[model samples]
Target chain A: MKLQRELQIVNRLGLHARACAKLVKTANQFESDIVLRQNEHQADAKSIMGLMMLAATQGTRLTVITSGADAEDAMTQVQHLINNRFEEDE
Target chain B: MLSLSGTGIGRGIAIGRAIVLDQGHNDIPCYRISATALSGEIERFNHAVDAVRADLKRVQRNLPTDAPPETSAFIDVHLLMLDDPVISQQPVQTIQEQQQNAEWALKSHADTLIDFFEDIADPYLRSKKNDVAQVVGRIMGELAHSPGKQPSDLATLGSSLAEQIIVARDLTPADTIMLRGRNMAAFVTSLGGPISHTAILARSLGLPAIVGLHDVIDTIHNNDLLIVDAATGTVLVAPDEPLLAQFRELQQQHLRHQQRLTLLKSEKAVTQDGEAITLLANIELPEDIEGLRSAGAAGVGLYRTEFLFMNRPKPPSEDEQYQAYCHVLRRVEGPVTIRTLDLGADKQVDGGRPDRETTATSALGLRAIRLCLSEPSLFKPQLRAILRAAVHGDAQIMIPMLSSLRELEQSLALVGEVCAELEREAVAFNPKVPLGGMIEVPAAAVSADLFARKLDFLSIGTNDLIQYTLAIDRVDDSVNYLYDPLHPSVLRLIRTVIRAGHEADIPVSMCGEMAGDPAFTRLLLGLGLRHFSMEPSQLLEIRQQVRQSTLAGLSGQVTDILNCVETGSLYDLVDQLNQTDSD
Candidate 1:
C-alpha cells in the first residue's frame, strides 16, 4: 500500500502556521505514515513544527511518501488540499 | 526605584504586588542534577508539561464564542507544537543524556528550534520562532510556579495571583478570558493599545490597566510592591516609604470618589424639569445581574445571548436555550431585551455549525437576522426558547441588523411559524413578547418610521451605526481617531430614530458606548432620548449627570448643535451643553 508522489505548493503564503495547522490536521485523519521531502529536508506530515521548519514556499515541489493501509486515500486528500490552496483566497 | 509609562485604559489607580509572567530567558537556573535524583526531576518536568497541556485545553474549551477565529487558530498551533515529538521528546533526551536540569534542558532544545526558525528567509515564517518561545515560556512559568516547590508553598503560589498585578509582554484573548473571573487588581503589559482585547476587558471589568509598557517584565519581579496610576499611564516600582504614602492617599481618594458615586444608586434618573429617564444595564452573562442589583438599574436593557452559543462543539438544544433564557428572565425585575444571535463580523462562533460559514467578508456578509432566517435549525430553537422563557418575567425579543422591509417580513413570518409549532406542541409560552429592532444599520435608521410602526420598541446601537456610517472599523487602531461620535451624520441618525419613536408613541433607548459616556449624557437627553442602557459600572455616574440637567433648557442648544455647519465647533457646543452654569 505504499505510495509516493511529487506535489507542488500553489498557495501564495506557502506553509505558514495556519497552513501548517491545516495540513497537519488533514494528515492526522488517516492511519498512514505521511512524510514530505524537499531537497534533503524531510518533515513528518503530522508535525506542524516539522512542516513549518521545511520553509516550503509557493511553487516549491515536495515528494510525499505515504505507507499504510490508507496510504492511497491519505495521499489523495493531501494532494487535494495542496491543489485547492488550503482553502485560502490567495 | 524604576518607572515605566504606557497608554492607560481608564482613570483608575491600583497598588499591588507584581506577578511577572513569561519573562525573557536570561534567568533560568541551570544546575547539575544528582544521578539518583534524576528520576524525581524527570517526574517533576513531566508533571509540569501535563499541567500546561491541561491548562491550555481548558482555555480552548471555554473560549468565548465571540472570540476572533485567529484566537483559536493561534491556540491550536501552540497545542500542536506541544504534541510534536521534536518539542516533547528532545527536551526529555537533553535532560537524561546530558544530565542537565529540566529548565536547562528545555531551554537548550528551544534555542535550537528558535535558531532553525530564525534562519528561515521568509519573514512570516521567522515569526514562528516567537510561537516556540511562547510555548516554552508557558512551560517555564509552570515549572517555576508549580509542583517542584514544597506542597504547602504550592497552595500559596496558586492562590496568591488573584491579588497581584500581572506583568507580561502581552496577553492573548485566551489569557484575558482565563483571568476574567479572578479578582486581579490591574494589568501592566509590554504591548497593546486602547483597542486591544486586554484594554477592552479591563474597561469592562472596571479595572485599571497600563499597556505598551515595553520590557515591563524585566524590571518588575515577583512580589515587588508597585503603584499603577492609570490616570497618568505610569508604573512606579519599589517606591520609598514617602512615595508609597503619597500614592496610598491618592488611591484612597480615587476609591472614595467611586464610593461617593454609589450614593446615587437609589436616586431616579430625572432631569430638573420633571422629565424622567429610564436607566438600564447591558449584560452578557447572568452573573452580571449582581452588578445590575448593586447599581440599582431599572432592568436588563440588552442581554446578549451569544455567550450561550460560543466555544462549544454544537449549538444548544431548545430545552437548553430555554433554561438559559429563563435563568436570566426570572432573575431580572424589569423588561429584558434579549437580542438574537448577532453572530457575524468579528464575533463569529466556531460551534461546528457549517451553515454560518460564508464566502463573503464578515462585515457585509450574511450575519445576524439574515443568517438566522436562512438557517431555521439555528434560529427556531432560540425563538422557541425566548417565547417559553417569557413566562417567567418581562422578556422582549430584539432583532439586530435588519436592513429592509423584506427581511423584516421574512423574520416575522418565521416567528409566526415558530409560534404555531410551539402552540401545536402545547408548550407553556407567552406569545405576547414584544418584538423590537436594533437601529444599528444605517438603512434602518433612515427608515425608522416604517420600522417603528411595526416593532414595539427601538434600541440604538451606536457602535455599529457609527462604524457603518463612517466606513471605519473602530477596532483598527490606525483609523480609530476618525471614529467621532459627534459627527454631524451620526447625530442626525440618532435624531431620526428618536423622532420616529416619539411619533410612533414608543420608547427609544440607546444601548451603546455613547449612552454610558458621561460627557454625552446631556447631549443625548437633549435629543429626546429618555431611555439609556449601558454597562452597570457606568449606571451611577450617568444617573448623577441626569439628575443635574434641566431638560427645558437643552432644546435650544441641541437645535444649535444640529444646525452647526462647522465640524470643529460641534465638540465645543456639546461641552457647553454639559456645563450646568452656562444656561
Candidate 2:
C-alpha cells in the first residue's frame, strides 16, 4: 500500500542526510516494510544508508510505500512521523 | 607578516605565530589490507584503545563544571567507540583478514562508522561520528608512532600553529578548548557559524574567528603569515603596511568601543535629560540568562519559547518548561517576558500537526496564535507552566502572532481557566499574571491601541513584522532585498503601535534583530520606543547610542526622515546620527 504525505522541511538547516535516516529508521520500526520515494527516485525504508543517499533536502516532497498486513498502519505512522519532522528529541 | 581577510565572527586581536591543526591521517585510503599481519595490528589497536581510554578519563575529570554538555559528550563518545565491540573488534579482524597496515584498517573502520552515523541523520548523533574518528585516529597514531611522536605532543604542535594559524577547516569543541590561551591570533574555518561551539568559545575567549571561509586553506601557504579580521570575516594574506596600519586603527577603535561598552555595563540607561529607558536582553536559552545579568539588563524583554520546541521529538513537559522559566527568574532580578512559542507554519514542532496549506506564502498562516488555537493541548501546558513560574519571578506571558481581539480573548480565557485550576489545586502562582501581546502583524500594529488597553505591554517582533508587511519571506534570498525594515509600511506601522502603546500608558518595546542594531537605535528611540531588548553583544553599543542622544531631538530627526520620500535619505540620516557625537 502506498500513501502520499506532504512534509515541510522546517529545520532551519533543512532535512539533511541524518534527518532522512531517522525518518527511515522510525518508519522501519513498524511491522510493514517501507520504501520512500522522492521525486523520481525510490529507496528502501529500512536502510538508513539508502535513505540518506537520496539527499532529500528540507521542504522536499516524499512518498512512502508500505507492504505487509500492517501496511495501512505503517503508512499512517510514517506519515505522522514525517508530519512532525521525526520528533524534535530525536 | 602576511594578512588575510574573512568574515569575523568573534572579536579580539592577537599577534602570534602561524599554527595549522588539521584532522590528520583520518581519511580512509582506497587500498585494502591483505589477511596477513592482522594479529599484530589488532594487538597494536587494542593497546592504543586502552591508552585513549585513559586519556579520556583524565580529560573528563578535569573538565570545567560549567562546560557545555556537548563537550563532555564528545569525550564520552570517544570512550564508547574505543569500547564498542563492533568498532574495536571488527577493524582488527578486518586488518588480520586483509593483511593491511594499521592506518588502512583504522581508516576502513572509521569509514564504516562514519557511514553508520551519516545514515542516522540526527545532528547531535551525526556529530558524534567526529568523536569516533578522533578516537580511531588516536589509536592509529599510537600504533604508527613514528618513534617519539606522542599524542600529548599534539597540544604543543597546536600551540606552535596557534601563532598566525589560519584554521582552514571546522574545529571541534575539543580543538577549540585545546587552542585556548595559545599564541593563536585568529581562526578561519571552512564550516561553522555564529552559533557553533567554536564560534561561541572564540567569543568568550576574545579570539578572532572567521567561519564559512570555504577552501580558505588553499588560499594560503603553511607558513604564510595571515592577519584575520574576525570582526568583518576578512582574512588579510600578506597585507601591505598601509592596510595593516588601517586594520590596527580599526582594531583600536573596536577596542575603544568595547571599553566604552564595559563602562556602560554599570551605568543606568538614562537619557541626557534623565529619562531612564529600560534596556533589556532577548534570550533564547536559559543559559543566556547569565550573560544578561552580567550585562546589567534591566529585565528580559523576550525569552523565545521556540528553542524548547525546536529540534525535539516531543513538546517540553510542563515541569520542564517551569524549570527553564524559573531558572531564568532566579538568575536575573528583572521581569522576564516569555513569548508563547512564536513558531510559524515553517517551524513545526515534533509530533505537532503540520499545516497542510502552509507554503512559502504561509508564514503568516497558522503560526504563533493560530497554531496555539489549533493545537490547544500544546498551547495549554506552556501557558500553565509560564503562569506557574510567574509567582517565583516577575514573569509576564506574551502571546505571539495575535492579529485579532478574538485570539487575545481566547488566550486570556484559557489562561484564566488555567489560573482557576491552579487555584483549585492550591498550586502557588501569581493569579494576576501580566498578559501581553506581540505587535508583529500589521493588524496587531494597527490595532495596538485596542491591544494595549487589554494587554499589559506590547513587544514589536520586527523580524516577522517586516517579513509579513513586505510580503517577502526573509529566508528567501531572491527577495531578501525586499525585506527592508525601513520600508515605509513597516515604519508607519511601528509609529502607529508606539503611539497606541503610549496612549494607553502601557510600555512598548521592540525585541527583534533591528533592536540590537546601533544603526537603528536612534530611529527607534525617536519613534517613542523607550524599551529595547536585543542580543547581549549589541547592548553596549545601543546603550551608548541611547546615552549620546536626547529622546526629544532624536524623535524630531526620525520624524523628518520618515516624512522624506528619498529611500537613500533614511540611511544618510542614520549615518549623520551615528557621527553626531564625533562631529
Candidate 2 docking category?
Answer: incorrect
lDDT of 1 by residue, B1-583 (tens): 8888887877788888876664343478565555766787788788878888898999999999999978888888888888888777788877788877788889998999999999999998899999999989998878876544211121143543565787766665445545656788898887766655577567667788998776554566556688899999999987899998998899899889999999998888877888889999988777788889899999888998877776666888889999999998889899999999987666666652555465454567778888888888899899999999999999999999999988888888888998999899998989899999999999999999999999999999988898889987644545655777888899999999999999999889998878888889999998989999987878988899999999887977998999999988988899888986532
Looking at model 2 chain B, which ten-residue stretch has the lowest summed lDDT? B146-155
Cα lDDT, model 1, residue B188: 87
Q: B203 in model 1: Cα distance from truth in Å? A: 3.9
Cα deviation of B392, candidate 2, in Å: 0.9
- Pairs with backbone N, CA or C atoms under 3 Å apart (clashes), candidate 1: B65-B310
lDDT of 2 at B328: 86
Which lDDT tens digits does candidate 1 get at residues A1-90?
999999999999998898898899999999999999999999999999899999999999999999999999999999999999999898
- Residues A1-90, model 2: lDDT tens digits: 545555455554344444554565566577777877777877676654455445565666777678887888887777776667656543
The DockQ of predicted model 1 stands at 0.51
